[model samples]
Target chain A: MTTTTATHRGFWYRHPNLRLAGLLSAPMAWLVVVYLGSLAALFITAFWQVDDFTGQIVRTFTLENFQLVFTTPAYLTTVARTLGIALLVTLLCLVIALPLSFFMARVASRRWQPLLIAMVLTPLWASYLVKVYAWRAMLQPESGVLAWLIGPLGLESPGYGFIGIVITLTYLWLPYMILPVYAGFTRLPGSMLDASSDLGAKGWRTFRSVIVPMIFPSVVAGSIFTFSLSLGDYITAQIVGGKLQMLGNVVQQTYVSNLPFAAAVSTIPVVIVLLYLAAVRRSGALENL
Target chain B: MSISRPTKLILTFLALLAFAFIYIPLIVILINSFSTNKSLTWPPSGFTTEWWGRAVDSEGVRDALLTSVIVASAATAVALILGILVSLVIARYRFFGRESISLLIVLPISLPGIVTGIALNNVFTSYLGGLTFLTLVVAHATFCIVVVYNNALARLRRLGGNVEEASADLGAGGWTTFRLVTFPLMKSAIIAGGLLAFGLSFDEIIVTTFTAGPGITTLPIWIYQNLFRPNQAPIVNVVAAALILVSIIPIYVAQRFSSDTNKGGGIL
Candidate 1:
């Protein structure tokens, strides 16, 4: 350490830029070459196509991989289905998290707030596979617990398909939704609510007019997690999706047999998230996250 | 805010309902770990400690547990070094492309894990030799670094350069200033960050699935495999119950550091 420090005293001790360069080199090299480079290579690989007749993959740059992704009904439908599920999950999470978050952020006593947040967050640590599997048990038909519980209501388990996927995803990601919304709600000034009410706005009106507008960015921030996560997740869908395949499933399935197509398929989510990030950047929700 | 009794009651009811909804699955998982029913029908037909014993004794569970700990520790160690370096660069420097560097660092996380997983898989298969335990560690460390980076960056931002300058002015060298002054102040934040990173990597399945070789199995992989198998399903609950219990300490530590908005992403 002393020898290294003495050497550092030679040049690094004098030049701040050299010091910065020295400090940044390892991490930058690791992240840029390892992570960003991989992504760039993968995205570029998406453009390479295989010769169907020759049964050979060639790295000729072509739009055919993306063309197939954009044009094929199966690919298009999968994208839509994935996006649809993502949107639905985001919406459902909002519905569940809004009131729950409001309760934590505003309605619940300050003493209970941290506990509530912790309760919401603890599920995250409980292994994603386990939570999805637990839902798998509940969503099982016939002898499933959900069946037993909802049997009296004459509604069976959603039975591990699209609805099952959404429910399980909503369950998995509810905390992601709750926390951002809770933070947003926590950030909302109490005086704003009072001002709204004092201005003769009713509770619903105050919420609609004041709270909703103010909290919308946080909602957007939360939705980014729910939507993007559900979009990319194939595991939950694998456990409980039962014959239903999403875009993630498409990519995973195709990756082994058709790497180029899979890479192309992966780009759809990346593009969607980039666009979503761009949209939410205006909402100022990115910083809130 | 104006509150009505009925509204308060309704909000309270919703909060109670939300808590129940969040907790019921966890409660069921815990109960089923004790339940004698191997097939896992709820209401927990009967209670038994036998599964817990079996789970503890199970070689597969033990091995997978060890594998998860090893992978998480290696990943966290890498994350600790790289995160500190990245944070130091971003916090202390006012150089060209600084913001871009930060964005580059965060992209691994913000991009879908699948993108990251498959991209790394692509590179590993193409150039780095096919997926292995090392690949798994690299993949996990890539994402885990973000937590540590955020926490340390937040700490650096909060602490500023004054203390380091004071040490330097007193004739302490850069290394000395760091070892004696900066490191102690950054220790708790790094611990908080490392804990979050460990937790993230421990539970991670997406990236691990892509990077793990045919022979490797982390705990989540183990859980996924046994989740639905008729005989082993019950034991999964035991493992999960234990994981959840053990994971709390890290989550709590993370929340304690949540005054830093960067760590406010919290358990996610």
Candidate 2:
């Protein structure tokens, strides 16, 4: 039998906001405990010195970890290489995604639009490791399809190291980049583009003035994904790059090697990404994206 | 000279070419799953079902797939429950620190997976204890909860308070109203949210890698180790193809549902 809900029965109900606040408390606690607190804990560990034998950290804090991160050639090069890869990946995503997304937004038939969108997002659901492994197989020296296909073009060993890894990363992250761009383009006022053409502006000029401003936020969002994914990828570089250590690999190694110094190196990118997000939010790009 | 039909034709071809660029590699992987190559040879020398058989029989692969399923499902269910509760509170009431709370939830996802892995690993080892599948589920659910929360919260905000007021005025009880009105309306969003969460959790490797420790190896870990093995190439392809199949279903369903609602001037 249905019972009428007692209105304002409990002390907590005296203030509805307090009751609502209580309901929100669980998720907030999780955010604090897991997201914010873990980072704080990791940051503190970066300052602690590691014991030689036991592989335990000493309570005594020092700036030596930070110093080692700066001085070490391996750590520094890995950081540089990771940044380079991130930049390249972002550029590649932008180049390919911009036109494709624009076409999807502007040209596709209404019935086909959802299908196209689904096609773009399908890859995001695939098992990440399996996707990477698929690439590794596809990039194999003698047998990979690339080796066979590009043979006529005179490029020997099509899928060996850096190029192979870069190609794979581009393929995997392309969807992420395209989604935001598509969203941006879809939200644009179509009448403005019509007016631009009506005013006798050429296609390219109209695109520059009308399209770019609207889609800029999408580029930022897509760039964030491509850059951060590339920056944080150790497995892709390790597996596909054939044991090549990127910044992500360095972090893994440092954690595995029990090197407090290397651990400190990993902390740098976290700060960089967080700061980047903060800046984007401040710039009002978050809402646009 | 100003505008040519040939140029328009070329642009259309180029657009189709872009789709080919996106789809061809994946199609190759799918096609190769049925190839008879001992290694990953191109344009297969022959055809066979042997790899699919091998994929089924391999203990390591079998165990890994099982582990992956368990982890993904558990993470999804937990995150969905939490997402509904949190979204309800956020949508219905104004609270202090709401923006900051939302940011905290969203921030973990913005940072790359590796950083999250390291941070979670640091916490588990230093503050908690020996890592297990449970811990991996927890780590995965953290980010996944945010996604589900976003989807459900957006839906909840649109629903508003009229339904509850109507139910109460009609003499329906709190539990009855929630079950009949609020819960039924939330069903589709929750399904969408759950599907999204499942895809994410199933594919999640970075977070799982950190928390899995020594004992647990999921399908990703299994595939990772055997990626370059010449003998296992066919089996790997079969497994990879299977993974692709598994991942695409949920995304396709969700996208179709979401798009349908949008066309209907937003879902209730």
Error of 1 at B132 (Å): 1.6
Model 1 stretches astray by more than 4 angstroms: A1-10, A53-55, B256-268
Clashing pairs in 2: none
- Tell me the lDDT of candidate 2: 0.75
- What CA RMSD would candidate 2 show? 3.1
- Which of the CAPRI classes, incorrect, acceptable, medium or high, describes model 1? medium
Q: Find the candidate with the highest lDDT and give its number.
A: 1
What TM-score does model 2 score on chain A?
A: 0.92
In model 1, the fraction of reference contacts reproduced equals 0.60
Q: Each candidate's lDDT (Cα)?
A: 0.85, 0.75
In the range B43-158, model 2's lDDT, one tens digit per residue, is 78888887888889999888988888888899898888878878887777675776676667677777778878888888887778868778888898888887678777766767
